[model samples]
Target: MAKRALSVLVSGYTFLEGLRWHEDRLWASDFYTGKVIAAGLDGRVTEMAQVPQQPSGLGWLPDGRLLISSMRDRKVLRREPDGTLAVHADLTALTGGHINDMVVDRAGRAYVGNFGFDLMSGAPFRTTGLVCVEPDGAARVVAEGLWFPNGSFITPDGRTLIVNETFGNRVSAFDILPGGNLGPRRDWASFGAMPDSDDIGTLMAAASIAPDGGALDAEGAVWVADAIGKRIVRVQQGGRILEQIDTGEQGIFAAALGGPRGTTLFMAAAPNFAEHERRATRLGQILMAEVDVPHAGLP
Candidate 1:
């Protein structure tokens, strides 16, 4: 059964990802356009910054400067108060693949993830590490051996970090130590055992859900965009689906709960995930729905 139909909040984007609700607006990165934008419910859109190599994830520092993931260049760019972009953290030597999504705590500690392997080139799957960039701009690997870590969230108390392992068929969690280092990992939500195949097609087929970008609700539940299921689903801690919104033809890549009342659920959708295919058209859209719970946790 469907909870509700998704209405188009905004459309004509190349491909939207890493969306967040901040300061009464929706912020996101357009992969192909290389532009990080912010949109309001009134249909107004603003360009925040541009990353030449491309932008995927977004966050904010304690001083209010914006941080964006420069995917291809393997770097995190910071937008200064003057609106100029500068290098905040150089991850070229710390990561193996193109940098992907990121989550930043109140103290400005950023945990960024990567692809682990080349999917566009059809390369075999490889495990990767998660890099934690400190408030001083220093970076190091806090955890490793992850299978395509994507969306992430820091508990309001800043004690636990939960990350979705897209190809692992589970959401892994860790304790956020005093210095931002992570403790041993545990399965916060497991759809099934981790897939053992190296082929992307085989792994996708064996998994129950490929969780992508997501948002945490005030009730401690997460709304995850199911890349394999082509829908938006609310997930509990133990892999239970609390609510689901089916998208007949659109493929969702990101989710966010925002708006005046904080009940508006925003979803980023497209026809497909093919980079080349999306670059040729602006069919990507931001879909909106309503939920009972408001948002909580860090970006």
Candidate 2:
């Protein structure tokens, strides 16, 4: 891991997460601020939408409608072509915790994950599941027994899916079945053995790599936000760290690769991830660095 020269694209946000590069701009859910914002390389910024219940993951329907995860309400909101938000799916009965990151495929199926426990209030650790919501608003649990499934990615061919288990210290991969169900789970990258603990703090303390959120690169490696490591890492399969961007005092939670040439890497950075710290001070920023490989696969 080497310190690299990073550029600040924009600043003043309250905990940015679920970042994605789309349509020549980077979009992210400023969760604590309850806003979905978009920013471009030209420095233009826009408030795309607002989610009162707190927005997390973001995706798009087949018809180009926007899908936003309303975390507290346990629902997925679809921004219609006319800009009116509609309830796409209610996941209250399916998920146990606050829904977070998600990735939608070409066919408009969203793969979503959650916090898995009462994070801010401090609850015991529990393995959660990954959910799938169809274009028509049908939803179901596609896979189970995940340790805080945070960010995910789908291959461009729509065959493989990758999920980052932030507390599990690994990235998991699954095969996409013909009908959108996941076949089986396997380790795409294992940083260390799974912690035999039920406490969030204990689990994090034992983790060698907290794979939080990331984007898949053209070379098949993932640019991951090493949550507890205070840096952004490019990790290859089987737990090999290819590169790292030292974020220093700032903490990175998500990364996106985009720009005219797709070489600009954007990160959702904050001083720390504490809920109180973010709400009390809007120190979140979007940081950028240049990478050799362009982005590939669905966000």
lDDT of 1 by residue, 1-299 (tens): 54685688789999999998889899999999998999999869999998889899899999998999999999999999999999999998999899999999999989999997888888999989899998778999999988899999998888999998888888899999988999998989999975578899999999889999999988889998988888988999998999888898898998888899888999999988888899999999999998889988887
lDDT of 1 at 72: 93
Superposition error at 192 for model 1 (Å) = 0.7
lDDT of 2 by residue, 1-299 (tens): 44567998889889999888888889989987799999988767899998999999998877788999999988999987777789999998899899989999999999999887899888999999999999999999999999999889988788999999999999999999998999889999998886688888899899988888999988999998988999988999888999988888998999888998888899999987889889888899999998889999988
Q: For residue 59, give model 1's deviation from the true position in Å.
A: 0.7
> What are the Cα lDDT values of the candidates?
0.90, 0.90
What TM-score goes with each of the models? 0.98, 0.98
